[model samples]
Target chain A: MTSDAVSAGGDPRRLLADTRTFARRVRVAQRVTWLPLLVLGVVTFGAILVQAVSRPVTTGCRTTDAGEICKVWNPVLESYWLVAMVAAYVVIAGGYLRVARARGLGSRVRPYVIAGVAAAVLMFTLIAAGAGRWIVPDPHDLLNPSTSILVLFRLLTASGGIGLALLVLAWLERNVALLLFALGYLAVVLVPINFGWGSHWSGKSEGAAQLIVNGLVLLLAGAGFALAQRLRASR
Target chain B: MTGPVDTPAPESHPVTGLDDVVHQRVRLGILTIAHEARRVEFGFLRTELGLTGGNLSQHLAVLETAGLVGIEKGYEGKRGRTWISLTTAGDAALAAEIARLKQLIARVETTVPRQGEAS
Candidate 1:
């Protein structure tokens, strides 16, 4: 609130010069926050979520065989979510990219966005270890024995990498945000009972996965708000 | 008389140089706006400073000639955009001007200490 910039110990002359650069960065930082990163990311997430919830029920066999009815759309539903997850990654990655680009972060932003994507990739790597299960009727392999401790540990490490990168990004930007939630998700999943819930969330319709994924998405939205407000108020 | 001098001194005391630059409202406003926003479009500066087309043009010309500003043009989409940024010389001058103002305030504050006591 003290606009003239002088503070506890610095000479009046020193304060003005210090404020000069700070004010300049703050001005453009607004431009960066208002960029389209957050909204687009959230929308993509919503779309993926809607598909997860509704697709299984809506897409079914057109032909009527009564007791012998065969569904053509089941395979599409099984694969549709995979494509949705990839799109979700793209949108989420874009949100972080926008924050970096608008801030003129130069080399500072790349590593963080990379880390988040790496975490996503590591999740897929765990999924690959359970690819044997996904091959037939059951895609809910989150806690299946085939998932393996080694795969889970690698996925956890990847999440740790993401959390570290996001922390660094937030520190540089001077905001603490949904970073804790991201870290928390990895921790919650390590418990055997909670671990099954993740797969259950991803598979079971109108269930806990909706709650968790939507809640995580909301947390991301909160982080974006915190980031934008912090930018607007910086100088 | 002082010895013959071909050019003025490169740096001047506050009283010597500030008067010429400070009184031009448009240039000062431009400096303040650009001080807040490190750079702005030429049109934005004109609109924000509220100078007439010709008036803003003349003032900007003077600042540009004085090495206090630089202008460049580019296109955003099909529309042309002109960018204005304070040159290093301009930034230094503005910093010096702010310092000069603070110094003047410091001088006045000592004399007017009792006057501001109520607030």
Candidate 2:
């Protein structure tokens, strides 16, 4: 055979290497990348479950004031709500992953990461600005389902996005920009909602946890974008 | 005289450029389905995997993040639809993956041990 033909004779090790690399990427996305969220989801859900069983679900059954109502929800209703919350989380999380995957580990996530960071930073600033509190250290207003519902709706929109973004970080863990973007997305939703659900610092912690989540999201998004860009450029 | 120093040029990339190929079983499944059709739907993959929408979605996210598929959301009839397609890179990767796999199989088959002797 000519030297050209000999040069064209392929190497087997290259195929093995490619397979290993591809497998690693898939493995990262599927397993290693998802740990924190899985833990957070399980713990949060468990806490809520315990609370539902333990807490009265209503505060002022005997009081003569605007507190005469009992926490009237049965276990079944609570179960349904649990399922719903999970479903919503799953759906939102799915969106983040999708965006990440589409974007890959590179440029596409830049815009999203920027958007998320902007949102998170904006949220933190807003909270630091102290315009409002949705969930506070106080629960005198907790029974006010009307206001709670309003806050819940907002949480559904903003936090949902943050959660989705957090899930995206599997693909491009190398990008700190992605991590910032994830944090930003988290802050945008959580800073306000933390005022609704928990304490200021806890809200801050929510923001912090969001950083991790957002990191995941950015990685996933980066990977996705990288993959897509690579694919497109090839054609 | 030159005003300022410039960054050094980056090293050249690797040759036999299949590093970016999609080769996993599920990713291959994703590419195969996407390649065969104009667009593959989310629900379709769910049924194929016998997995809930959530699990399939996660996998799809992986495929998407890797740039092997393009997903377009729209409607078929009144309901929302998620349509996925292979990008050009994805197509190339798929083709490369196929050739690579074929090469691996050929290598193994030819190098098969004779009567249990390690070849």
Candidate 3:
């Protein structure tokens, strides 16, 4: 309270302790991770609807020394993803800026937004260049029991680059929880999961099931973080 | 071999290294928060330090005059807000102050006698 509280004869230990506590409080108060998590979750979940509505247009199939490479291009899906990803980044940036303005605190989310937008553009470019067809193969072969696991890694682009860009956000926020979630999410993106492999769940769309699961994971993490933030605020 | 080169001895005490502008408790808190946040609003600083508007304004003016902090006035939506950011000099001064504080604490611990000590 006093102007010269930390004068020469004063206790440096107390001042240092109080400063540390203040810094911790500021760090906690500025966190707004749940907004992006929830928004991305919804965007990812909506991918299933887009998948069902947009039919794949096959250009042609050719036989090569390596294998059969079919060019099945879906302009609808590509456009949807490009627009969705760019919009999501805009929404996230706006959300952070709004929160910062309201709370009178600054957020370090620009790097995350930039990385996300760049990743989305890159994914769209790669797909347009015929990378998706080469990696995914024929739709009929996708659900076959003998389908290669490598084929399923295509699901990593389910959220249109939002999945990998989360790592950038984790670094920006310096959030360990978010970093852990991002790593786990990356594993989910890379690993092909057949939810209805053996049970009554069979005959269902395997890709759709995987997307639903990914969306649920994001939603659940968002809810958990929101609750934790609430508890911290209440305390 | 040539004569040994002379090396200047360190300061008599770490207190000599302490910066007057940055040593006060409130000012140090302001600089610390600004350094961490990169840009902090004036209202947030006032609320966090539990200081009155006048007191916070006085401290900010001192910091601004010393060229240790930069002040920008802008509108956040319809409301006018003042933002404070630490300068390069401010950051360096804070680091130096912390180092001096650490040295001062270390000296006190080593030289000061504990309870029931012979000295």
Candidate 4:
């Protein structure tokens, strides 16, 4: 029994470092960050197909002092996202449960799922209440003075909501990596970069192209984290 | 380096402060993992420490007997699983062990010179 004792008589720093490393391994083993990221990434990426097939209808036009602001509605895209996001949330929760059971670990994935589904519901509600008209940028009104407000409104979109909900997930996980990814994803969602170059290559719309970029970020982050965990575990 | 004048008493050494039950290599590893995870599974502990089920169980039994760890034997689904968590006493013991280890490190580092350094 005495022989099994750690020889703290030796360099304790190495011992401390080894202990910390083992703790990190345990943490990485239990994390399901990659699961949610991959799932959400696929959903966001798939939205491009829905966007491509659905035609935007100019429902109505309102005359304001600034100019004519027309309401653009894409019922198909909206409906598809509503179902997709809900399903994604369910799948993520189930995935966590499965992994936990298989690995004999406990999972705190419920709050994240709840938060994600809530965001999806909130987006659907806003759209149902006619707030969706205000979200889309009207082609006719080019230099709208409320551009900042419009950007803020992006938080209500599916991608933006996913980003926002991830902050909740990050908090629950207490993982700095997830928190950083969530912040980065939120920035991309709010002020989407025009990846029109990718659109031309893929023959997809600019909207779809942007979604693809967001989706790629999710997928890459997911894969990167999973790979890192595996490497750590192997070590 | 100055010549040593008098040796300290053995009981005054930082290593003396280490709890025998918590200071063992496997038991220390278990406590550290449990402290970090808050709640850890028995399988994870066994795998992480590279210990057999019986070996890990013996260590866990020692920890439980010392009131350092709380172990639960329950079923996750149809399969029964064991979960290990640090009790308040366990948490305090771990903290104390680390603190002692740090003190031990500091003492050794200050008294000992690097290989390349002038003695």
Q: What DockQ do the predictions score, one after another? A: 0.05, 0.03, 0.39, 0.25
User: What fraction of the reference interface contacts is present in each model, in order?
Assistant: 0.07, 0.03, 0.39, 0.41
Compute the interface RMSD for each candidate structure: 10.5, 15.3, 2.7, 3.6
Which has the higher TM-score value, candidate number 1 or candidate number 4? 4
Models 1 onward score TM values of 0.43, 0.29, 0.79, 0.67
Docking class of 4: acceptable
Residues B1-119, candidate 2: write the lDDT tens digits. Answer: 88888989774323444443354445565565555443556765555435567656766788788787888887746978787777898888877776666666676667677675854
Query: Candidate 3 or 4, higher lDDT?
Result: 4
Task: Give the alpha-carbon lDDT of every model.
Answer: 0.49, 0.48, 0.77, 0.79
In the order shown, the candidates' Cα RMSDs to the true structure are 13.8, 20.9, 4.9, 8.1
Q: How would you order the candidates by TM-score, starting with the best?
A: 3, 4, 1, 2
Residue-wise C-alpha lDDT for candidate 1, range A7-44, written one tens digit per residue: 22323344344455445443444333222234333533
Q: What digit string (tens of lDDT, one per residue) describes model 2 on residues A1-235? A: 2223212134455444444544344323322223334433443344344444442233324443545433332333234334444453444345545643442311123333544444444443443333233344233444455655545534543344345445464333443444564565555544542323333443223334433443444445546555654664487
Superior candidate under lDDT, 2 versus 4: 4
**Runs of candidate 1 exceeding 4 Å displacement:** A1-29, A32-235, B1-19, B22-25, B35-38, B74-78, B116-119
Task: Give the CAPRI rating of model 2.
Answer: incorrect
lDDT of 4 by residue, A120-155 (tens): 888877865567445545534433536676576777
Extract clashing residue pairs from model 1.
A201-A209
- Give the TM-score (vs. native) of candidate 4: 0.67
Q: Of models 1 and 4, which has the larger DockQ? A: 4
The lDDT of model 1 is 0.49
